[model samples]
Target: MLEVNHLRFSYGKNPVLRDIHFRAVSGEMVCILGPNGTGKSTLFKCMLGLLRGWDGKIALNGEDIRQMKPGERAKKMAYIPQAANPAFAYSVLDMVTMGTTAGLHGLRVPGKKERTIAEAALEKLGIGHLLERDYTSLSGGEQQLVLIARALAQGSNTLIMDEPTSSLDYGNQVRVELQLRKLTEEGYSIIQSMHNPEQAYLFADRVVGLRDGYVIADGSPKDILNEELIEKLYRISVRKVDAEDGKGRFFEVIY
Candidate 1:
């Protein structure tokens, strides 16, 4: 349900993203993969309309994102950053309820039904116990889960996460990955930027590979995660092995 065409962005006189084009459909989990400084995150910001002065068009369906109001855009898409640190010592429930502002307008309060939905979102992420905890006091993983709960509370049709699993340990990474997979199965379009190709191959329906501000490959993970492409894009050797399921495989970089 998201489309980007000839998208371009720059910092000062230096260009960072060039002619990037891709489409993500409903019920699809798409991963944008790239090494450091390749502009994967910049592409996302452009799509979210957080950056201007860029050329080309980004739209949800046929409507231009630039034309939509901030609240309107928030209702259509939710963004989860690589990290979120709350300024105040807000309660977890209070932080998540902030997402409802798009639907609730200027007010920041959540009614009984909205609170129920927020609590359910927390429970889904397995962080129900943190509801009453101070956000700044929680651990990194806990805070990440709370931010995800906020995104879920936003209840947008599309979820755009930047390194959603970046900071967590291996186990917590798996937990969040599973939840993202479940979200896609339930009909939410998920677009995530990741540095981990293995996770991208394992969880993404399609992979969009970026190199030096341009899209190099966009296809099924199996097709896009091969040794040649990985080596060329990231300058690292990757090995692909047959997965037990037969329908998919596992990937790892060879040091």
Candidate 2:
């Protein structure tokens, strides 16, 4: 239930994003796929109301985001940025509990109810044991899961994740991707920026291919993740091999 229409943005005199359009429906995962420097993050920032100078309309369920207050927006969508090592050590429960305050207009404070919601959120992600652990001491995967738990606690069904698996190991990447899939199955709408075409192909129901800040292709992964598009997006010669496995056949890139 999110729509970004004809979005354009610039930094000083240099334009970074242009004519970007996309939408995410309930219970769907839409992947914005592009190489680095293709304005993927810029598009997300504009959609999230973080950078409001852009020249287009961002709407949530047909309501312009600009007219909605910060708390109102927080009630409808949750943004999960890339995880990094923390500078200051904070309790894991303390971190996730912050999400419960998203809808608090002012004087936001977590009480016993908020703490219980945060605990349930951690349990939803199957990381309940990490509630007392130091956030700075957890593994990269655990930290990422905690971040997702925090987003869950925000009580928003629509999630925007920027490069959700960028800094994780392969196993952790798989873990996060599977969690995202499960979220969609549970009727959460997700819009994620990803550079890995294979992951998008495997996980996303719809793929929006972006290059030079323009939408070059938008369709189902089976229709968009082809040899020509992959080669064009990466500027390299490649072939798509239909590989069959226990799960079924999928596109395998051959260079």
Candidate 3:
């Protein structure tokens, strides 16, 4: 389990996150929902140890992450950032193999075991055919999947993604969401920051709503993602409608 308590952060004197608290358990998907610049990314940076001077606690499986070394932390969690543009056109397999570096020693190169792990990750995400392709040549969604495969190869039980579907088309968005759900079912804890409340409603077991650096709400998506909260979060009118198939609900913004 991942637990965060009374988390607070600031840039110099400009406070960003305050009293943020949440927990994500294995086999569960949690979505952090809020408008842009509500410190969602900042909160993620704090959890990932990319930022310092944070006041509070972030722990994974009862161990304080702040007390762990960089390599030790990587063993506990993995982060998938927004799609990156690689300077060099590295092959998909090479990119995925990079995840194994944290587990390797000095002057030691990836051999059969690392290659196998990378191959397994790609196969798990149904992208094994792209193994020999250049990562830069793939579409946004494919690149995103490759990044996820890298994280999977990292062998952490917890995955943190920043706007995993932000740059994808409708079809790709749905595809990524479905894959995330599958990962959770396979017992990988996922924490992703997203701006879409409907995605939260459809895919998240828990939703954490952040507004102006504060946790405005935290609960199951069905209970916490109502029209009122939607309006409050985005400052825009929206309505919730039951899906035709009755599997779940979706939010429609009223412009």
Q: lDDT of all the models against the reference?
A: 0.87, 0.87, 0.92
**What are the per-residue Cα lDDT tens digits for candidate 1 across 33-110?**
888999988888888889999999899978999999988899999999878776788999998888776788564567
- lDDT tens string, model 3, 142-208? 9999999999999988999999999899899898889989999999999999988887888999999
Tell me, by TM-score, which candidate is best: 3
What's model 2's lDDT at 153?
93
- Candidate 1 deviates by what RMSD? 1.9
Model 1 C-alpha lDDT versus the unseen true structure: 0.87
Q: How close is candidate 3 to the true structure, as a TM-score?
A: 0.97
Mark the 10 consecutive residues where model 3 has the least summed lDDT. 246-255
RMSD of each: 1.9, 1.7, 1.1
- lDDT digits (tens) for residues 1-255 of candidate 2: 898889899988888888889889999999988889999888877777888688988889999999988888888899998985656798999999989998565676899999999999999888999999999989888899999999999999999999989998889998988988998999999999888887887889999988887899999987778878887787866666665564422444464
